[model samples]
Target: MESTSLQPASAPAGKFLSRFLIITVTICILISPGYIFFSERGGIGFIEGVTVKQLLHLIFPFFGLYAFTLVWGQIIIGTCKPLIKKIFPGIGRFHRLEGIFAFIFALIHPVLLIGSLGAVTYLKYEFVGPNKKIFVLLGVTALLLLIVTVTTALLMRLPWLQKRWKKLHYANYAVFILVFIHSWNLGTDIQGSPLQYLWMFFAVSAGLGTLYRIWRAIVKRRTAMSAQSATASEPTNSLNPPNS
Candidate 1:
């Protein structure tokens, strides 16, 4: 007899390394577009009138530092599930931790971005920047998603909020797209580089992967329902066995 929550070990390849690798790979693919394209512009390109080299000098380190952190986040979620499970004991809570980590990273990302720009703006008055208000609003929305997703991870903490948190987390997809669009609109350097194409390639791949997951989930649900239905009908038909 199999328990509902605990399954036989042979159910599937639920190994920690496998899950970690998949999640890490997915997140890397997800972040690659933004990081790769945004990276090249350097510091001078970001600042209003600095030469490309100067901007690169100022900006590259900050960018590199964050990229290092971002890659770690991916690896933690993708490859380190076993460790997480060891620490947390249960699947749901462990899963929530993943969301929490993602939220933390997302929160830091925009803060550093805005802070860096603010510093630059204070340092020089080379050009009037675009509507920082709009940028901030979009950024805040992204941050909020991380916050909400992290909050929802407490399934036992707030059961009613579980569905809501999940729904809010879905907004991350929207946040990602908006961020990219905002970057494209404001990314002056992307105008002439191959970066845009590469970004698009990664973005499309990530989106398609998400869609693929959705489809697989739906198929699994349908299969489950059909199998249950068949099992349920077995006894009824056996009593009066249907005519051939």
Candidate 2:
């Protein structure tokens, strides 16, 4: 069957441009929190007023937000793709790429933060600190879950594991929730700034998409059950009629 859907071949350059715009937008959103915080530094000399460590402390969450946004984007796309496929047939194709990008930023987030705080100090504070223990624990757990999600996404193409891949992919949503809690509570940058608004926007957007996906799945299952019940209750044709 010949396909009628639009293909990148028809506008290869336009396709590349579209991808570029998407990535650029993602970068802008990711950098927004850190940029706004830094800009609020008023009259202080950019480099002299805030040491590199201080700057990194302000910026690490931005990188983390980047990864979290990508993860949420994947969830939204995965959930909404079926409904919107007619308008944007290739939208779902970005899910794997989004996962990879999420993993990369997720890695950068910790590495920068760990660099800013020496490994021993960061570990002690994260694990045994009096006040921030729970927040750190959630963040670390989210990181581990993110690893599993990315690994599953990478291996999902294998024929042997294709069927189980989606069940495992659900971890991404859990990671998203954990990361949000970790940021909202512990991130000073996120607490009072415009960044909080951005975070809330993504949270609500992803939440609605998730709810729609769940509702659609429930409706589909109920429909299947009704069809099965109707089939089973139907009268069977008999070879011998009863005194017809």
Candidate 3:
């Protein structure tokens, strides 16, 4: 007999909360374009007679920024999973969903940019170095890494590949750094706007979160090593007792 004992009443509530978070994040992403459009009026050319291509071009940064936010949220939810579980036990489910949307918005950013400016022109600006070449290259590199990471994530559902998922997911950190550099340097919308400072705040937050995780890993490793050494020493000491 299959028992329902394995699940608790909180399971449904947790699932509901996870879904609510996913939906809220999605709504935020959708509303960003309108917010940025109105906020930047002349800068975004939202006055009148804006073509679809122009609109997409104007909205590109918002998508890119939102993508970063989603991935950053994934990092936060993951790094603090234990704490998050204590509060919202099922929130872990949102981790994968955030990654999925991050990749989607990231893919859209470049597609829209290419659509606004033909492929050749886009590539020229992105690849050919006049001065801003480095920032463009950083963005391209991050996008390529993001593609691989997300594809690997999807592949993780396969039983054979599950073990390697953690290793592949580490690429997200590198992607975050690359995207941060690219956006901070070349983000026109961020320049001289409140968004610039907000972007910086996120950058610092992500950086600090990453550093703390690395520190935790180091401390954990050292603790494990010390415990192993003590255990090994105990066995040796028993074999050769110190004179009393």
* Number of the top lDDT candidate: 2
For residue 1, give model 1's deviation from the true position in Å. 35
TM per candidate comes to: 0.53, 0.76, 0.76
In model 2, the Cα lDDT at residue 132 comes to 70
Question: On lDDT, who's better, 2 or 3?
Answer: 2
Please list the residue runs of candidate 3 whose C-alpha ends up more than 4 Å from where it truly belongs after superposition. 1-37, 42-48, 126-129, 157-160, 240-244
How does candidate 2 score on lDDT?
Answer: 0.78
Clashing pairs in 3: none
CA error at residue 3 for candidate 1, angstroms: 37
Clashing residue pairs found in predicted model 2: none
Q: Ten consecutive residues with minimal summed lDDT in candidate 2?
A: 1-10
Where model 1 places Cα greater than 4 Å from the true spot, the runs are 1-105, 109-136, 154-158, 161-165, 189-191, 241-244
lDDT of 2 by residue, 1-244 (tens): 2354555455766656766776687688767755776666552355476778887765676688677777777777878877656445676666678788988988888888888887998888753448878888898899898898789778988996699888988888888899888888877767888888988988998899999999999999999999998887665534346885
Model 1 weakest 10-residue run by lDDT: 64-73
Candidate 1 per-residue C-alpha lDDT over 86-107 given as tens digits, one digit per residue, 9 for 90 to 100: 5335755545555565555555
